[model samples]
Target: MDSGETKISLKDAENEEKEQFKLLHKYEAEVPKTFEEAISETGFGRFNYTLLVVILFPCATQMVETVGMTYIVPVAECDLHLTIEDKGLLNGVTFAGMISSGLFWGYLCDALGRKKIIVYGYLVTGFFSVMAAMSTSKGMLMGAKFMSGLIMHLSKSKAVLIPIIIFFLFVEFHAWNVFMLICASMTIISGILYMFLPESPKYLMSMGRNRAALVVMRKVYSKNTGKPQEDFPVKKLVNEAKQNFTSSRVEMATALKSGWEEMKTILHRPHINNMILASFNAFSIVMSLNTLKFWLPGIFQSISDYQNNHNGTSSSMCVMLGEMSKPKNITSSQECSVVKFHAWNVFMLICASMTIISGILYMFLPESPKYLMSMGRNRAALVVMRKVYSKNTGNPQEDFPVKKLVNEAKQNFTSSRVEMATALKSGWEEMKTILHRPHINNMILASFNAFSVVMRQVFSSLLVILTFISATCMFCIYFARSSLAVTILSAAGTAVGSVPENLLLTITLELFPTTLRTIALSIHLTAQRFGTTLGNAIFPYLVQMGCLPPFLFIGIFASATGLLSMLYANTENKPLI
Candidate 1:
């Protein structure tokens, strides 16, 4: 009787434990999973590697479009009847477009969607690029280039030397138009490729399309894991949308009001100082980099011209510039013409083809899960993460451990549209705030730095080591005995100068809160483009003044900015706000 009672008790305990596990599993099924929990389930895999490859094309095309003009200006000078001033205008016009359009594009990217703007923007930019290639007159070309810059504001540069090599190898045969067409074609290809890409999962969630975002994540998981969508572990996701805007139409008044509020937040106390520092640094670096870079080929061409005419004779940069500035008469017999099978034409074609390939490949990339989390679409974000986990670890989705994620701050906004006049009034009020007290001081400092960096032509030895090296190199170029020495020193200066441009941008990114980061960067880029435009516009005048003026201008500004950089608080391990 005792043995029978013990057996019965053990059986009952075992049954009770099994029943409890069943209840736990059922409860888990009903609970919504967080983005972190979902994403943790997905492992790293082939999809990530593929996404990286696709991103490379747009980057390459941007470089080609911006810097290609540097090469073309030199070769096309005779054909286009370009003077020193005309060359400066052409080189700087692209940046002028960028400066004007940066904020506009940023606004659209947020309101519409990043992928949409990028896609349509690239397509339109390509058309403008083609217009630039076909332009017969200086004004027409400038207009076209400006348009290209306006549309192509999204993307930058260590690969400065590529166009120089390309020009040398190809400009001997083909006209500049062919190269422009090649760039245009690349933009078109990038646009087409962008069509296949999914909208940002975060953007979808922000718009209250949780189910759509989930579908996208499921697709990504399928691609990454080669698994059926039905096999995904999570049966449902948590809804995180804070506002549901019902209207498809967006009013300018509404947009303006919304934008003004965001701008006020960015211009507020804590971020103002960093913004000022970044803007100044951007202006200094871009002005120095582009002004010199745009004119480098011209300098080299002048040197080549002198060597050809004065066989075996050596001269300084100042002497060459002075000689080139003197008037020369051209005869009808000197008419410019294009040659066949040019190397530049071929190289541009190759670049365009690669861009197309990258665009096409980019279709496979998934929306960023982190961006999703930021938008409070934790469930959608988790789905993306799980896909990644499944692909990376080659594990069954159900076997993934994490079942929940922490909730994040959700985006909230009012749906009621305001009148245009009210929006304008509000915007003006916000703008006025930046003109006051603490903000005003930093703004003045930034302006002063930009003005001094662009207008003053001087150099000093006391600065950061790299900038010092760059200054020393510039000084050395004036006294360089051989073409090779000038080439080496100029190249060294250019490479060294690029380091600070990247560093300043990186620091700027780390200095602001997520809400203000994009705006700060936009301001930073606008300052950079302004610097580029002003520097290039003035460079020819400086050259006319003397070679030393231009070199001194670049070297001095570089050093001054380098010194200013020392004052920035260290951000190495600082957490993002």
Candidate 2:
């Protein structure tokens, strides 16, 4: 062969190999994968634990905001000389505030960033809360309470403050003013702690900040395992970033436009129906729980007074060092004196303190990687995975399932412009998709569940009242008084009935795609606030209409909710969109 022919032959061979490699890369990119698949290899570790811990404060604070009023009215009655109207206003005002602002915060969480809303929201909530504590007039107190609810945006979670609420009711510490101050302090503490937490990686990537996401992952890994950033998977992250980072530049206006459209999407298709159902369910749960909670102190006070009168144990009217008067009873036409209990005040203080501690603990956790992946920042997701893998497996990022995760994310690699346009357009299309055939069935099921949950809450409250009435009947029949028995049973029954209430949040989170999750939740919570306010406002009227009608009304709703469960979508083990 001639030298010229040999050189030409070599060049052709090299070119062919290069083309083959490109073809191979394209083929591998088509393989389907998910964020969960990538993250699963990381194993649950310090990252998750810390995240859970940090989230606990927001959860606790939320509970305090919703249920705290129950404790406050009883303790503050003496100092503030509260009227029944004033107490009712206080109970509903926080929820009213939340309902009004929930959409605003939810929009921001989806548009700008989750961390920003959370940090600033809590700080402002704290400031208003302090103003509420220092108020001397009912009008000032009501205004402060309204403002507190307006600015605060709380995260949803279960099992944070239930035990505290129950426990504080039994302790005696007369300090309502101090407790209010403490609740305010917790809000401030959570805001400060949140400042240290990482922004959601999904949010960062969606903004085209791949390098920043990688840096956060390294920081998390170093903190968890005492491992240096040098050992982190820089190469794999960079490669993954190449596949995921869609636009070299994500315009602020474009991103905002996209977010506004995404927010609109939840109100519209497959998402809209589910979103409606979830919101209704939220309405039911919050309304029922708050209605019962706010009404309890008043009912118990009446019960204690009635029992004391019949038993010939004159309830204390003057403040004694160790003695507590039975709760005062008030009728619409009768004038009532201020009544206070030390134990109830102390309970409020303890709950506020615990919430503060929870905020402090939450300061250590990382942002959710699932959120990061959704924003199209696959590299940032990789960094989080490496941290999880290093902490759990005691291995370097190289040993983690980087290839699997990268491959999965690469499978859905649409260009930035196309992706944004699709998201914007998706609002109407997704709603249309949901309205069609099988998906619509799920929406029907969700609606039924929501109605049932709301109705059942009413029933639960009535059941307690019925139990008391039954006990009263027994006492008259056999002269066998069991007031203590009735009280314990009612409290226990109410607590048990509320056990599954918060799971709605988790279920809603799982049911919706990441893009629509926050807005859906926000809508749900806003609906809940509306329900709570309505329930609290109307329960007095319902009671006036007669006890049996209220119970009957709730019974019908609960039955309907149970029947709808039969049509549920059976979403178990399904991959989130």
**Model 2 worst lDDT window (10 residues):** 315-324
How big is the positional error of residue 248 in model 1, measured in Å on the Cα after superposition? 5.4
Task: Tell me which residue pairs clash in candidate 2.
Answer: 54-362, 172-343, 173-342, 201-372, 202-372, 269-431, 270-434
lDDT values of the candidates? 0.72, 0.59
lDDT of 1 by residue, 96-167 (tens): 888777767655765677788878888778767766776667788898899888764344321423653444
Report the lDDT tens digits of candidate 2 across residue range 286-368: 56555655766655554455555567443221111011222334443124343334655545655777775675655455567
Model 1 misplacement above 4 A = 1-27, 40-42, 152-174, 242-255, 265-273, 323-328, 331-334, 337-463, 570-575
In angstroms, the error of model 1 at 175 is 2.5
Question: What's each prediction's TM-score?
Answer: 0.70, 0.56
Q: Give the C-alpha miss distance for residue 193 in model 2, angstroms.
A: 2.0
